[model samples]
Target: MKPENAIEVRDLKKSFKVYFDKGNSLKEKAIHKKRNRYEIREVLKGISFEVKKGEAIGLIGHNGCGKSTTLKLLTKIIYPDSGSIDMCGRVSSLIELGAGFHPDMSGRENIYTNAAIFGLSKKEIDERLDDIIRFSELEEYIDNPVRTYSSGMYMRLAFSVAINVNAEILLIDEILAVGDVNFQEKCFDKLKDIKRAGTTIVIVSHSLDQVERICDRSYWIDEGEIRAEGDPISVHEAYLTAMNQSMQERLEKEDAEVMEQHKKLGQARLMPVFCSDIAERKGTFDVEFSDIKALNSIGEKKRTFHSGEAVRLRFAYKNPNHVPQANIKFSLYRDDGILVYENNYEFATGKVLDLKDEGEVNVEFPTFGYAKGTYLLNAVMYPPGGGEVFDEINNVFKITVFSEERAMGVYLLENHWEEA
Candidate 1:
């Protein structure tokens, strides 16, 4: 290990044996040996990284991406198949809280038992016992049997004991959701204090915002390897972009399958091409929306966009009756039910659509001036003068806007500041 580094990992590799259906009893195992067949699943593929002393880093990836496995190796809870991990100081982990607790033991007794697992001496645990109990806010029930405590209480006690250990290195998994929101905030503040005290911290979490607030650096792990590592915001932006692309591909494939199924069934009307399974629909069947998608400047489908980026809504409709004239309206509403933008084609251009057998329309926005938040989309087609509602799809789609700037309100306006 480098002298300046608190943790050094070299070409780490690990795998596990995933077994097929196998018998539990000895007699059944002997009779059906073939049922024990298994396959080797490689979780970490020669990944390497180092953490400087007193620096906090986060491991982020989708589930089953070997991030948790890497943390387990760091804690020595699991052995790596091929690689070396070096640590410069004593380690403590919040991976499995209450691992050494006995259900019948009192909360106070379990605190000592859990602290002992971190190699604390009897005198050392005695000194921290009061602090731990106080931090857990369980003084009233400290002497009660842990089995009688609620799930939140139990977790609070475990977390208090672990955090008070004051180890030189702390490895935390996704245990921040242990208690209520208030307690969770308290834990976050404690972590910040620990960082200021120069303790080396490594976290594995799916909450990107948490990582951004706490970690000095972030490593993006994917498919058993390190895909990117650097500043939290940049790395997370790349990770989210890749994830969005993957989702787009999946949606396209599923849409194609749905179209094929409709053709096979000879359905009179095809289902909405891009509407989510839970999307609500209401229409008179005289004119029905067959497809609706939110796209970017280059005509690529996307549900997420940066605030001020160009956005366009592309929709296709079928008019079996060939209605002479119709009006189209699209509205955007924030998740809290506040309307952001709503406009009709007739009002904007003094023209209404001359309906035909089938057609597609593109509504373009050069700059989507929405703040950073999710907005619900609604599409409506009705008579030119607004009589009977021909069709209306509530929540036809959800558009998410992201912004790097720090500001408030519903609109992302263009402005500049200068000294007078």
Candidate 2:
């Protein structure tokens, strides 16, 4: 059988040459050649992978681990030191906040410029302009320079133009992290529609649930290499297990070192007492455990949910400092890190959370709007009168979406359908 692929890569390598001074002349170039050589920042490390047509794949790894570097090479934003990105069909990328736009231009003008760069004709941009503006929900601000727009607004317009390009293959990074709830939902619905049109997608996200939900498969990258690929669940599980193990190992080593230092110094850094217990979803089950580390709580909470079910989460914890009026938020992701839902509990309007008490606060949201498959839930706690977020909870839970007997519309509709 011939090698199967939609995107082909072999022995990919990329490096950046760091120049200390920009004004160096030819004489300096010669002198540097004879004396000090330019420093190299090796980004991609001889990695390789292939993506089949109509397949959705997720890429995940630590920060600065060449995930974005590979995307840049694929999109031709930067040339690789070695290797090739062999792609067939019309391709488009929503990499790095979705679009390249000038801040001084109006939304309309920037859309025109960006669309043309994506290989669309002026007439094509004109045809899509209305659709773009409507989707971005920036009709009033369309005439304003993008420099005046908020980060969320800027991202909205950029994404609006990106999805309308009608490319055969689309590349997306983590742009959904900034938009509000309503806009994010709209964009996600559009993504589902785009996938149905047979456009291949490659998403690089920290949202494991989004990857597991939409991706036909996934690619796990580690240390600039493809560590795992195939089914999203299997690959995701493997990665999580590995990460947990690594965290455990590090904690153990640190504990031993700290104890040894304390013996010699008479007293050492005071290790914070851990609540220790945490909730985590193991494949399909919800897990709770305590006292594994004796110090800081060392695990995450995870669960799976189906559609139309009452999605309820109770957060329980202990913090010494009293939080007077904190801005607490919950974020949902369809794994691979595409942010699905996010909201903060500010003491504004009708928001209230008595985190000072020992009782758990149960957060309930109807889940009928979500499609079938597993989803991830993230919870964040901020101190009262927040200047900076002190702590974070990562991938706390997983929720599954069901749509068999429960199926009605694309997602479960809250309204009752009466026969006409």
Candidate 3:
């Protein structure tokens, strides 16, 4: 236990004994012991990590991957079957919002009670009560019974108490996503302040963006073990790669019959990559592609298409202020970044589309005559004349074109074979 190390966990392991066919009736209960089928499920297997003072660490993994269990062990909410955790500072947990609150107590009373449990004295809690209430934004409801508070209200109060308790180590478990966007931003700002003030924080979250935003270092836990640990960006990228493969395998196993049929039809899998940095929205109005899909000749949404087949690029954009006229541009690029086709809405159709405040847009291509290769989509929106880009997507949506029925070049043109 070094002076500057807030937490150091060593060889941590936890497991549960799960039993099936435990009888409900008394007679069956008597024989249940002999008939019971039990298995040991290892939830955390020899995981070890450390958090230094003033350092923010993120734990990211799939659901049921022992992330919450590790937090519990760190907070002493649950004991590990083996291994040890060393801590040098008072800890505060935002694991379960209002977990220690007496439901009948008023929000104001719960604040004091919770803070006190976090080792705050009466004087300390009193000094911090006003700030907690102010940050929660529940001034009027602070006196109301906590049972009557909405989930959001309850979480706000809980987070307020946890953050204000002045604990040196904060264990946050995905609770910062409680409120709306404004409040979430506020919470992140507060976390930044806390980090600057030298509070060691451990956050477990599914949002990679949140992890990358707040964490200096991150650990990726998988199947009760530390799969990867390093800087947030690299850890997150590795985790995503693993998760993507896992999802593909699961999907294939679950829907083998359907996938086989598609395969037999020469259809390729569609993989979409979302690039958040490329989307540029300057003004109040915004344009971003949502639910972009490719439909086959039969109007079924698919990821792959055969040459000379009808493929429609169906997508929707958000325009809260209903910008009446915006030039829509979509470009098709080869997998290796060579531009294959580019077109503008007005240039291709000779007129602009009637803008809706929020609606779907369907662009149908009569025949997809591309070569047998993968193509990526980049959709852009510009204010009518086209100098300023309102929004642009760089090679995100993907479509695979198979050449079973058409030529091997970029264009799938129609021609007649005649004796000349």
Candidate 4:
């Protein structure tokens, strides 16, 4: 029988002392007379949450964000520095799949060994051994040494043994990502069955889609703290928004630093120019695209084009000083930010041009090999090595392409199909 509250964690805090070794041998250590220094790395800060019987919870975050550490703490693999964890009923953990199995032992022997570690008696193991091996689909290789098993095979056997354990609380740490798609679906179906049978589960995974599908709720952990706790989909959305914002800020800062270095080198002047057209302008101080216009096949200033039509992209630049070594990189992106193609002017031609005043640059795409959809054009100016970008206009222009044939994806590959 499952308890009402399967697990309750209160102000959980854990840290480890990371060591820096000076010498490996005792003689060397004595000669150096230096002690190894250590730094305290806090893996889990004060965090609190609860899991009810039959509830499936998810822990999501970037790598080293304490998701795995929390699972380890729950399994008592490591003791917490402070705080309390109230766990009820028998617990079985698959922290690292096949972690405790003997490499030289046969898969059948390893199953008995692992199950015994999970608190199964010899008679209990005997009763479930056939079912476990059948579930893993490894009956032929059950007597083979585990060292010869492939990763997917190992995972199948490990998960099979784990699910067979009579555990009220299951701790899974991204083990489901292993194996083929068919086996993955089988694992999901099995999980659903177990969940319906009142088995509590805690899964730590990077796959937000799987998390949202399997977990009743999710907690986004960041910097060893609970950033958000709510519905799985909403929590994942919040996490993604925060991650994108942080990435954008870091990129902007890097761009600013690059421009500042260029200013110090006397390459260009730093001036924050204001854009008169808010809808089409995007850039920093070093360079700016004041006006951009797209021309169709008939030389008309339009933002839409037909398949295989000639499209010309024209843009005028504004700069404070001469950039003799600068080049322009033009790229096409889908509405969802997938880059389709990119081309550079000076880099392709092996020529450098000076831009001291308002200059015009244009590029023509003779064959617009894209399916019917809306797209964005991104223009960026950079130096020879592209170590730093002078200025970039993301989504400089939004254009739509028309096609007669309904394609599945964005690209249009030239292919002729005939049935044999």
All candidates: TM-score: 0.80, 0.59, 0.62, 0.65
Q: Write the per-residue lDDT of candidate 3 for residues 1-420, one digit (tens) a residue.
A: 877788999999999877766666788778667656678899999999888999999999999999999999999988999999999878888887776799899999999888877888999999999999999999998898999988888888888888888888999998878777888898999999999999999999988789889999999999999999999988887786666556545543544455455455553433222222223223323555545667888887665666668999876767776677777778888888889998888988898766677767778888888876778887777787656666666664467665533234677677778898
Per-residue lDDT of model 4, residues 237-307, tens digit only: 78876765565466446545654665565524333222111224334447656566778777776566666
The lDDT of each candidate is 0.88, 0.68, 0.80, 0.80
What's model 1's overall lDDT? 0.88
Residues 1-420, candidate 2: write the lDDT tens digits.
Answer: 124567888889988876556436887677666444557888788888888877778888767878887887888888888887788889888875535689898888999988887889999888888999999999999999999999899888888899899888899887656589888888888888888887888888887877777788888888788888889888887886676556546655664564466556543322212221223322110111111121111223223333555555555545444444444566777755667667676633366555452334445564435765545555556654555554455555445444433243335556688999
List ranges where model 4 is wrong by over 4 Å: 1-3, 22-35, 257-339, 342-358, 362-420
Question: Taking the tens digit of each residue's C-alpha lDDT, what string does model 1 give over 98-152?
Answer: 8799999999899989999988999999999999999999999999999999999
Ordered list by TM-score, greatest first: 1, 4, 3, 2
Residue 43, candidate 1: alpha-carbon lDDT: 96
Per-candidate clash tally = 0, 24, 0, 0
Q: What is the clash count of model 3?
A: 0
lDDT of 1 at 261: 65
TM-score-wise, the better of 1 and 4 is 1
- 2 or 3, greater by lDDT: 3
**Model 4 lDDT at residue 255:** 42
Over 4 Å off in model 3, which ranges? 22-30, 258-420
